[model samples]
Target chain A: MVTMQNYDNIEYLSETIRVCIKRRFGDDCEIANIALATLGGSNRTVLFNVVRGSYPLRLVLRQETVPSEYSPFLPSDMQYRVLEVVYEHGIPVPRPLFELEAADNLGQGYVVTAVPGETLPKRLINSAEYVTMRARFLQQSAEILAKLHTIDHVLVPGLSALQESSDPLGAQIALYDRYGEPHPAIEFAFRYLAKYEPEHGAKNFLHGDFRNGNMIVGTEGIRVLLDWECAHTGSVMEEIGWFCARSWRFGRVDLAAGGFGDRETFYRAYEKASGNLVDRESSRWWEIFGVMRWAIYNIMQSHGHLSRERRSPAFAACGRNTGIIEYDLLKIIAKEFD
Target chain B: MIWSARMFNDPPNASELLLTVREYIEQLLPDLERQDKYHGLCCTYLLDVVMRELEEPPNIGDHSNNALKALLNNKDELSETEFMSSLCASIRRGDQDGNLDRLLILLTSHVSKKVRVSNPDYLDTKDYL
Candidate 1:
């Protein structure tokens, strides 16, 4: 595995990609236009083009730069397998390419065919250019999620390792305990979710972080879903609740459905598409779960910075951001808490 | 107390210093590459956090501490982190279920004060706040 220090050497990175491309395709394979993507925080995302014979492929190489033992994200190979399975099922995800093997010495990661579109939530919501996307976003997102939840978890063998289906709330509580940062609001929400655990909901394949920023939005809306590292088998409503969580809404709190439209519209579209009844009460429970998960994410990033595992200003901000998220979580669960 | 604090600290106080650096980064952002620009934005956000903290220190004063103290009756000597941690254990153990209504209020108030320091704009939820 290549250390991140050497990972930053563009010449070395380009050579590594070239070798991987040659190994996957043939000696004639030519890799070009390799550039690092600027958006994501945890992964080192690179955009490049590869050509062999008459075929041209624009690809994304997502490398796990900040590896942590206590992290909740699935291993890189598992994430790749999930993407392959989802793509095979006709989900609108990027086409998975070859995984970087141990021999490649570039560390753990994989390549996928890049999809075109803007992913920034603020721009997608506020821009006039995205008016069409905004109009179609709710229906499109709901339809995609509906399709995603319909996929058989048996198709992805790696998913069986995840225990989220058996006890989703317990799995999250265990994750929070592993992080070991205590928050009264998170503790309260944990109890609330445990006490009011939804009695009925089919366990379905979920895009564990299906929200605005994780999808690509063009004029049509939702070109492809990205980030399958958090994929798990869990209650279908968990996916819905995560999508509608206020943290993912950016500044458009009014538009609960990923800052694109109303929750009612999204729920109706999803219900119509998935053939599953929209459980509003259960959805509220999952929404609280989603908010607590967001707060836990903040703590994880903050700990990463504080513990000197991977220090950055962005991560340091997450420490304070946890407090902001806690306020949101408490407000949402206040009625039930009382 | 006789002299202005600004005179001893020099012209650029902590807030002004952060503001100047943040302004410089903002001006330099356009020229940087996309990756560098993203980092520059993160730097600006961190600087803003510092400025906010300097302008409005965390309002977990005696009143808030007392609220936390009241919740964990035996932990009068505990610091804020200890108090919160103890409260978390109590909540997890269901020992605080009877007092949840009161606990919720205290936790909400404390987190609200935190929000005021971290990002006050978040508290301006038009629908809820």
Candidate 2:
């Protein structure tokens, strides 16, 4: 097992919570437990409750993997843009409690915020509760997405300043080429992308990872849309197709959209709220993009576990997922070709 | 042998769970020639995660593309085949050079790019272990 010591020390973590809490709350409060969830996060996140006087304030530690601070969280500026805007729009997302302009007591640069709600590892997608509420949930999500897309750039200065992907298609080809680098399967996908490029030129918001799993849902509707780390302004339908991607179908293969809801349900809800017809061809093209994207991820990630620094059943297992992307792509393309 | 919580608790530990399922998979696993049970799990999980990721590869980023463009600076715009060969070559070079971080960065970059160009939102880091 990769030990926690290899990354950062507890003292650093403790100090981060203390400083951030103090910055947000006050100097007198005592932050305890300071438990960090290292696994399954884009950045380091910790759960802690602050004690002051007679009561305790519970909070979450959110570390934005700033490119300036670290290597992995590339496109840091974009992440900050999404986080700030989503939080501002009154969308149910983690409140933007803090931003790390400079590395504080915490060894790494991060942002801390209010913990939204309980997150369940076992998804509600396959649960009986989700059966009837499927359409309602989807409509709610689409309505929320509509509000997000209409987010006025003037409110968040950063998003307005952020540049659109200049050569999204060429850039994608180059990017995927790098990902599939050294892997023949990836190369094949690259070849597929080269000859059959889709129409680009989309200007709208893209919540890169908008899916059922990322959402923090409970007794009420979705408490908050979590994980804005990958948010950007790209093909807006990217979000729609992503929500409908087959990987999320869980075990309910019939529900193509997150494996429980139909596409029509999702689209109707989106169009109804956004007052914009989701271009079917654009959505179709993005769906193809979805498959190619999945294939690239599997090939590169699997190749990592296939390499030396990584050797866990998990990594090995992760690498194995590449073929599923290939299959999704084949299925998507076959239909288009026919 | 009967299952025991002493060692195997609710949602039995992955290793233990693997052992339990392996027992059942053994009947089918043995019929296949040359592939050991361990490799079968490896290959199967590899396929599983890959398939899951194919649903959504991690989003490709801007600067990462800049990095790839930087690495292949001198060469002519590379064909997909050339890109793969070069990537494989770079990975091999990384192995020979003893650069762990560079190799990881390369792998990460490639996956990011692949998802960007192909499925866009199909695969994500979550699908991987």
Report the number of the highest-DockQ candidate. 1
Residues A37-94 of candidate 2: C-alpha lDDT, one tens digit per residue: 5333245566788899978866665654322332223344446556777777777776
- The reply for model 1, stretches above 4 Å from the true place, is A38-42, A51-56, A66-68, A335-338, B1-11, B57-60, B124-129
True-vs-predicted CA distance for residue A123, candidate 2, Å: 2.2
Chain A, candidate 2, TM-score of 0.81
> What's the TM-score of each model vs. the native?
0.92, 0.65
Residues A1-338 of candidate 1: C-alpha lDDT, one tens digit per residue:
46776767788989988988888788988988888775244567888889877887899999886574676787788888889888998898889887888878888899889998898888888888986677588888888889988888888786856756677777778878977676888898888778788775567888899988888877866799988888888888888888888888778888888888888889999999988888988887888888898898888888878977656677888898998888888888775321
Cα deviation of A45, candidate 1, in Å: 1.4
Per residue, candidate 1 scores C-alpha lDDT tens digits across B13-80 of: 76777899999999999999867887788889888877766766343345766877776778357775
Question: For every model in order, what is the number of clashing pairs?
Answer: 0, 37
Provide the overall lDDT of each model, using Cα atoms, as 2-decimal numbers.
0.80, 0.57
